[model samples]
Target chain A: MSTTTATSGRARRPKKPITLVGVDVYVITEDGIPKFDEYGPFKIEFISNRGTKVWPGYVSPDLMLVNWYRCRFNATRPVTDKDVDAFVGELGKKHQWSAVQKLWNYGDEAGFSKAY
Target chain B: MAKHVITMLPGEGTGPEICEAVRAVIDHTGVDITWEYEDIGLDCLKEHGTLLPEKTIKSIAKNKIAIKGPTTTPIGTGHKSANVTLRKMFDLYANVRPAKLIPVLKRPWDKIDILSFRENTEDSYAAIEHMVSDEVAQCLKVITWPGSVRIAEFAFKWAKANGRKKIQCVHKANIMKMTDGLFLEAFREVAKKYPEMESGDIIVDNCSMQLVRNPGQFDCLVLPNLYGDILSDLCAGLVGGLGFAPGANIGDNCAIFEAVHGSAPKYAGMKKVNPSAVLLSGVMMLKWLGETKAAERIEKGVDKVLAEGKHLTYDAGGTASTDEYAQAIIRAMDTL
Candidate 1:
């Protein structure tokens, strides 16, 4: 038997950390009424801001409880409750009160300060 | 010839029996292989308190090649899948499973040869799941640019090398605009590099229907983790079942060959399960090691045995035990 040490020929790529910047939340509705279903009602996009470049993050329907609209965004920087308050403030500007109520009800029911 | 050292993970249940049979048949091929035995799965969990031991990982890392039998993973509860863990730990990003018509065990499609390249790491297989509340839960599906690009590059290279004429990117991009869309985009970008190859994209649901309707239309398929996991099994069904399917998890540094089927704990020592899956996997390992002549000899040996219809195990519609079937293949190899 002959002996020869084996080595990997493939080159390794440098690992870079992807930073999560913001999140886009869209309440799916039919005829301006919020549609409660497993596939939708709330569609979320976790936007990533890698270095100075911004790219579209992964999108998924929040298929949790039909009543509760809660989603988590993993970010390189800490996401404070103040950040969520600002996000909710933006939601109030664009969406109807009834649609926005679906989000706020979570905080009301769970006795939390903000909708996350 | 330089003797190759390989990490041998004889998994669990019928894993040991099938691994033994494959080892015997591979030895018959006359390739110089020194197997470094390692423990994995439930038995290892009992002894080492983990399904995968550090020593086992070190062995595969050192050898850069491994052949494993089917390992049992606890369902719903207990530790995560040992197979998934190994793939993630080793960064075995590309999972290649080839389903071809074994002429002897004749099926509907005479020319069913579909090679599937699955993105092994990331996607939902990342297991990044959380319970938002008592009644609510979510599992994040991650798709990174680097992850997608590497897998696409790997698939295209593999297709070009293997003389595959066409390659299809299977995804649910229509519904998943960003995640699967990025996966499709990466595949298209990679396809541009290989101008000689024909490339196309299909929605995963449509691809599944097309596969069952007429499998011959597809040559090579590349998909993200979840879809690839599901569709590879479907491709296996085209020629035969999981019993005849062989899989290989390949990374830049290392590769692990295994049977796509699960370890049947119920049939552990019965010696009744078929050994073709693991045997064919061994053939793949031989080919990866550049032992082409030995690989072909083993393939021909297996084909000869199956064609004779005498020593097939229970899964293949015969009454022969696992050892009997393995012996038949070894006996057939002598003539070659």
Candidate 2:
């Protein structure tokens, strides 16, 4: 490897930026509205989806961590079809399913916030 | 080179149409075929308390090759699925589908071609379901080393044998680590043996996106049973739809070929709906039978008839009925 010339300019080596290490999901359920309480307070962990990794499930709910599916970030609330419809509709409108998948579905988006 | 038997189960929700469709296509060939039919219906729930009869499973065990139509898997616990029963009973490890551009139909895609070797026997389809509570339900997804190894091996061998260039192990390794993780681990282990072929891992969801985006880039994809079911259908959509998809369930000792389609109950007794999937499935059966010449003739006839698109079915944007399309295939065969 060739070293950068100190007189000309210092080469900026590529470095992975630090990111939010943990997140969780919780939803406030309004009275009289029943949610699809199928799976509750699901913990999402991130992992690389491009390369080879051991898998018993077929998709990544998270794409941030490595070698673990038990994520500290959790989404604990009853999800409604309206929410699903609105999310999908918004994704379609913006052509942003891929982006949305990163944040919520695959857990790759670095910018996840708690939803009420 | 040898005679084979194909047992057909056009189970509940779809009746006789698929059976007739398959029979019409194979009639074009000279190969010797023996078949059996099961007197099954939704009544199986009342009589046997099951959708799959013990006799049908025994028949599959004895002959090893059976073509079937879609069956009803009630979302409830009343009767288990016949498809799942057959998958478990035979340990039919690989579900294979071939989607090819027919050079006739105008679709959302062009020059599209895909082949899939899907795991047939295990996963959530294991029928290991239980009622958790009044508010929730659970289906246990079981993935074992042998299950993963068998399917992955099938993918590689199929890719190499079929002149395919790559194998993708589709998985969701993020959420359920141990279960999905085992599948990925087995793929990595098995991938070492087939360095001559390319291997890639696509997360199941992305596999969905990329497939719809650029289906032409894929060849010989391997997925577990359930995921394969969904992906193969998606690929079918890229080329045509389920009506053009042909499939086979193969074990070490036995095999069966059939149309990879659903029961269009609305078209029942109408002598309609495309028989192309089952007809091509018959062609695949011919290939498996070593009747490559007969298979070629059937496929060529299908190409010729479908290329015209005039005698096509409603799905193909034509008015031709099932019998009409079958006759078209037959007429194409006679000319061939």
Candidate 3:
């Protein structure tokens, strides 16, 4: 087996950042409790700046959601601990008690704070 | 008549012999084609330090059409498949493979003419992977709406153009709801526009069983990358084997016609392997270039030779060598 590097053989161009306009969140609940798994509790549909729905624009329910939150709002400033707190606070208000509480518990259990 | 310039990658191993055979047969049909030869596969890797060189890509890009022989890809290790790389780089999303039975071959079933439209890019072929832990690894199965819609539209258009009545969308949406579900949704969305044509969906596993059980039941099939890759080869088995399968990777701007088989390295210099796959691929190339008369001549000649059950290579259960088989096709064409 010849160890050759399989390159695209085409010139590389920088990828333009996709501008997110809005998001549709479908929250799944079981027995009045938010069901969370690898796919996350909510299925997110991202609407691009061009009004086209971005396929595969969903995010996992990990610390990555924080990055998605920042991008969705177009926050150019650096992320702060206060920003993370406010994001979780907004989620609690929008999705109600059980889901946000479960997310926070999972965050703690997964050591998301330390990782961040 | 205007001469057509085509990129010809004879590839490696038995590629050269079969490609020369196709060239000779095409010449006998009286089509004026200037072959722009390029190198790929292991030999090119040694010289250019890449499986696909810049010159080969340039030639194909300039000509906008290419006919290639089988290129070798290492198993389980080494570089990525040059075939997959070419398809991706050119955005050749639709891989069209037809399985039409030659009456003389006389397999288990007769009247098997099925065309498979496979999504050539995306899905697990994206090659995105990561190791989360020492014990676990993950690979993402990527399926996008645009990718799905384009391939579905291509399949329907080709079917309609070819006078095919039914088109089936093969998928496993029942299992991977979101990923495969998106693919199925796109197929349905596209099918609605073609109300005059019949359209339906089938699960991948069930589709496989149905294909072998009754191949005549399927007219055409459209599928995503992985499923298409698997099922297209299965369809090839229905008519004969890969030696009889001719494939095309088509996109909006460009198209590539190729043999859907591997370079038989063990029989590289023997000149005993069959050249039917590459020769049929040449027939496809002629049709793509609007040289219908030449295409028909080659097709008729091949059919005549096969029907005679003489002058066939070892794979076809005959004693003739590769050059002898090719010469027989040329002689048959002269009669036509």
Candidate 3 residue-wise lDDT at A103? 12
Candidate 1 per-residue C-alpha lDDT over B1-336 given as tens digits, one digit per residue, 9 for 90 to 100: 349999999999999999998999998888888889999999999999989887997898788899999998878656778898777666788999999988767687757889999998768775644433334545657676778888899999988998999999999999999999999999999999999999999999999999998898999999999999999999998887999999999988789999989999999999989989998988888888899999999899899999999998876789999999999999999998
Cα lDDT tens digits, model 2, B145-217, are 8778878998898779878888888988887789888998999899999999888788999989988888878
**Which should have the higher lDDT, number 2 or number 3?**
3
Point out where model 3 deviates above 4 Å.
A1-116
Candidate 1's C-alpha runs over 4 A off are A1-116
Q: How is the predicted docking of candidate 2 categorized under the CAPRI scheme?
A: incorrect
Tell me what fraction of the real C-alpha contacts between chains A and B each candidate also makes: 0.00, 0.00, 0.00
Tell the DockQ for candidate 1: 0.02
For A52-80, candidate 3 gives per-residue lDDT tens digits of 11223321111001001111122233444
Rank by lDDT (best first): 1, 3, 2
Q: How far out, in Å, is residue A29 in model 2?
A: 45
lDDT, candidate 1, equals 0.76
Q: Considering only chain A, what is the TM-score of each predicted structure?
A: 0.26, 0.22, 0.23
**Candidate 3 overall Cα lDDT vs. reference?**
0.74
For residues A1-116, what per-residue lDDT tens digits would candidate 1 score against the true structure?
A: 96665645554444333222333333332232232222112234221111100113211111011211223232234454456556566555544333221111132232111111
